[model samples]
Target: MPACEITIEKIDFEEPIHIVRITGALDAYSFPDFEIKVRDIFEKSGRNIILDFGKLDYISSAGLGALMGFAKIARQNNGDLIILKPTPKIGSIIDVLGLSKFIKVFWDEKTALNSFVSKAG
Candidate 1:
């Protein structure tokens, strides 16, 4: 199985948004790959990000910490990072740890995408 896989699809908005889908396990060993993928997006000045974690089966504290940092970066750039369709395990951790307050979680893709529009408008 892959340690971690990240696929980005760009959605054209007023400023464009990226839907980043994560699969496999996101642990210490795979954190660098994840960081690279996201850092590249920020480097291009793309801020709106939706992280689809439905296919991700495992995530360590390192992964969560990385996410927090990315969220901050996105927000600082007039955009934000949201979570989409996270599994129950991931959802529970986000809720219990109060990450949900910092990150919005949506089960529907349309709603998640629209949220960025609403924020921008």
Candidate 2:
């Protein structure tokens, strides 16, 4: 089995942001659970989200699609989904796939969270 774990932590910024940290391989086998958890968070909290990719080592096409899907949902609900500190490998994949065009990517967590506030203000 591929090693993957998804954990969400709420960050208490002036405007709260949910940080979903994914670790290990996010491939076909693990993406479903990841998708579900993110959807649930958006449904329950309706807060903006920052996907922390600092610890994420790998991401398959399915994983990328799941993220795009969730970002779409977040946008429709007046929330945003930002990507934070993707590993170089994953960052390249995201760039090649044009995911960054849809979701902004930040090298720093504080910058990513602050982006949401700047947009609203």
Candidate 3:
């Protein structure tokens, strides 16, 4: 049997932005863990964020709820959240939910990260 695992990690950027890379399934069982980790990081930094979904395999409604919660928190702090490298399946899910209207999606990390600078005052 294969070892089942889900992982999330935070990588700090230069300033006012951070990347949260998530991998594996993000269903109800794992959403809370991902939510907690992300919330804790945001509570401390409260900066712009990039959610890197390059390696993420799946997500359920609970996972989407968790992401919405984090988006609210980011917005409350005047920070923005973007997503990067989502697979077509995930991208379609996001589109169906109309989340793409509120959250920007990028095909590359550099472009996603650069948006903050270009849009800055």
lDDT of each: 0.90, 0.86, 0.77
Summing lDDT over every window of 10 consecutive residues in candidate 3, give the lowest-scoring window: 1-10
Top candidate, metric lDDT: 1
Ranking by TM-score: 1, 2, 3
Off by more than 4 A, model 3: 1-14
The per-residue C-alpha lDDT of model 3 at residue 85 equals: 96
Q: In model 1, which runs have C-alpha deviations exceeding 4 angstroms? A: none
- Clash number for each model: 0, 0, 0
Please provide the root mean square deviation of candidate 2 (C-alpha atoms, Å): 1.5
Residue lDDT tens for model 3, 1-121: 2222544444455456777787777777777777777777787875688888888888887677667777777888877788899999999999999988778899998898788778665
Error (Å) of candidate 1 at residue 33 is 0.5
State in Å the error of residue 113, model 3. Answer: 0.4
Model 1, span 1-121: residue lDDT tens: 4678889999998989999999998988887888899999999989999999989998897688779989999989889999999999989998999888888899999999999888878
Model 1 scores what on Cα lDDT? 0.90
Task: Return the TM-score for candidate 2, rounded to 2 decimals.
Answer: 0.91
Number of the candidate with higher TM-score, 1 or 2: 1
Candidate 2 lDDT trough over 10 residues, lowest sum: 38-47
